[model samples]
Target: WDFLESPGTDEVLYGGAKYGGKSWFLCVWSYLRACAFAKKHKIPKSSHPLKVGFLGRKVAKMFRETTLDTWFKTIPADGYVAKGNPTEIIIDDRVKILTGGFDNRELVNKFNSAEFAFFAVDQAEELTRDEMALLRLATFGRLVVNEKAIPGKGLLTANPRHCWLKDEFILNPIKQRKFVSALPTDNPYCTQKYIDNLIDSLKHRPKLLAAYRYGNWDVLEDAEQVIMDSWLESALNRHGEYWPFVKEYIAIDCARFGDDETVILLMNNTDIKEKIVMPYCRTTEISGRAAALSHQNNDCELVVESIGSDLGAGVVDELTELGHSVLVYTPQGKSSEPDKYYNCRAEAWSKTAKVLCSGVIDEDSNCFVALTKRGEGDNYGLDDTMRGQLCTPHYKWVRGKIVIEPKEDIKDKLGRSPDHADAYVIAVWAWPFISMPNKSGSVRHRKRQKSPMSM
Candidate 1:
């Protein structure tokens, strides 16, 4: 099947679940275009070579090991030759396929000078907004297929993630093009047994099944924990929980300097229950000392910590003066043990994740209740924390501790503090103390009652 019946004039987005023929279609399109270009140019069998560039995210090696490798195997052996070095392939003596991940700007730039009849972005969702814009500009006025003078057009295949392209590129009202969603069902290659297995897997793992098996973007939006408005509601609900007898409370402070919102979580824990007294997050200009002092408590301890990068030790003096026990933890050099970091965050988040995932938190907590109502089935509130803490690299747990190692290159490139996520790690670390313990007498009585019932 010809995926691109008409090229150059229109933008094509082939997005859906895993094993959908999006990548297959892309490979076929590139292969055919290379052959067509050679034939149209009347190049002798070994004379004319068509050059094609394939771009992926910075983590393209992972892509190569997975999707790109699959594409390589799918292509007929007669027409393609895989190079020993990378995903690069020599096709038909007259065509060259250059494969690159988005990490190298220089490699992407190389395509700007060469005139290629076809350009393909394998996993378009992985590209940042700026990178996508650059790719668009690079392909302008370059695609010429057949005798027909066609403008340069590119093909994008991706599973929708939280991004601007979903709004601007796919759902844009101005673009008069059809948006086709190709599910696993749409692909003849996928078997019914495979589909059944996917459905079964999704029943147990909704998030992965939602993203990879169903190709449902709603799942992505709804499964998120921290929507902007929901976050605001949760933050504002902090004031509503103030009780007159709520003394000797603990505050877990997750500080951010700029761009990142400093999150301060206040909790009142008794023997029976723990209540969130306040959860305030905002971008404040307070120095480290001022921020440390602002959230101090006379009767309670302060878990003031740092992650991503150490702001400074100025907060220690201020926190100590307030008659509070201050604990400062640096996440750097800790993430080398992936199991520890993963387990710590998992344990912390599990307390809340259960509520969020099962939609139970939506019932008991008015903060989450109001937020979910405002979200209209979108889980942006939950998603924020998930994306920040869960999606951020180096959050993997090795044993049971939370570890965070800095990626200087990523930090430099992204130009923002991963502090929001750092604050989450701090919150997770503080989770054990946040909840109130059950009364020992109540537990003993319950055990006695259960013994009589069992008898």
Candidate 2:
């Protein structure tokens, strides 16, 4: 609390175990700022209004329900009255707090020009680096009243996740700041019994317990990789044969020689659903794996082959003989123009990761299930495949939209060759066919629209 009130600190990161008073602290800070602005600005006590923005990713509604609702209850009934959307709050006409989701780009831009005495971001880990950078720049310049001082600072409360913020903001040399670690025990209002009960409930759920109870970023139990659990869950929920209704289906094939598993990932462009119908561990011959692919939805046309060596080429030939369209891609020579190695493979992996993180891909289905079941521990062929597909090089956008440049080094350096990695490349290659048109009517339309499968 003291550090928050202190001046000169431009950025603050409050991360720790969940059930802590982090959310409450943000509420208090915002309320105090609103009250201060009301008193100092000399606008009528009734008419003085301060605008504050709260941002989140998926649980926008949940955030409002928990934090914003709790905040209102904490304030005396006579001091403030609830108004506007439940996601937003109008406190005694002195403060207008707006809640927004990160997925809605237009809504996020609303804060770009508006000045507020305070700004808060809940679940800061969910925000993209681009979004954070935009908010930072927007909050620059003079305040609404004080033409000299910056309008207001921003507060970020989140459970630590594997993200750039861990490196850029928290560890950045320029931002001389301190991080406050809060635990469930820190909340004076909550009882020990209550905290214990909550912890006990999450004991069986390693990921949740690690994130919410223990505040450990390294603990990702269910997912073999670091992809968000929500993304994985959503994918699983949307899986079915109806997935073929999408425009394109691309399969990425990563072959395994010895203890490794040969994985095949089937992806459709429409809803971004992926199915790992074939993930065979300790497989040598490609013929058995080829038999598995034969069982997948046959309507999808295109297979992207991640060319590795002579053995990989043989597998591709076997797949081709099965009457499937295939595109063979090999790594560009180290001296090839920009970078050596397969640029397409690298781009495909990067694109796949972006889609997963953006919550665009659905993982719940035969594909994910097969991959997880086959790839376990030190023999994480499928696991490495997924990570390679999801971890792409992203550019930092200080202002406006940022374009991501592909990285060859990242593709080459990632450990192990994954059959699922091949599937990721295939999925990305087929992405354009699946993407839905923007509401704004920005692009040309493709004539063929595939039918969706039953969920």
Steric clash count of candidate 2: 19
Residue 21, model 1: lDDT of 77
Candidate 1 lDDT at 146 equals: 56
TM-score of 2: 0.47
Candidate 1: worst-modelled 10 consecutive residues by lDDT: 441-450
Q: How well does each candidate superpose onto the true structure, as a TM-score?
A: 0.52, 0.47
Local distance difference test scores for all models = 0.48, 0.51
After superposition, the stretches of candidate 2 with alpha carbons farther than 4 Å from their true spots are 45-59, 189-455
Best by TM-score: 1
For residue 207, what is the lDDT in candidate 1? 68
Across 1-455, the per-residue lDDT of candidate 1 in tens digits comes to 33355642456677767667787778777777666766666645454445544434445564575556656677787887767444566766766767767776667676557555556777676678887766666566565545554455567777756565577555563352335576777778877766664555234346645766777655555333322333333432333332223223333334444444444443332111111212223213223333443345433455556554443244445456555466665534333224323333343333333323332232332222111111223312333442444343422111113223334433554465544444444544453443333323211100011234333
Error of 1 at 325 (Å): 23
lDDT score, residue 147, model 1? 53
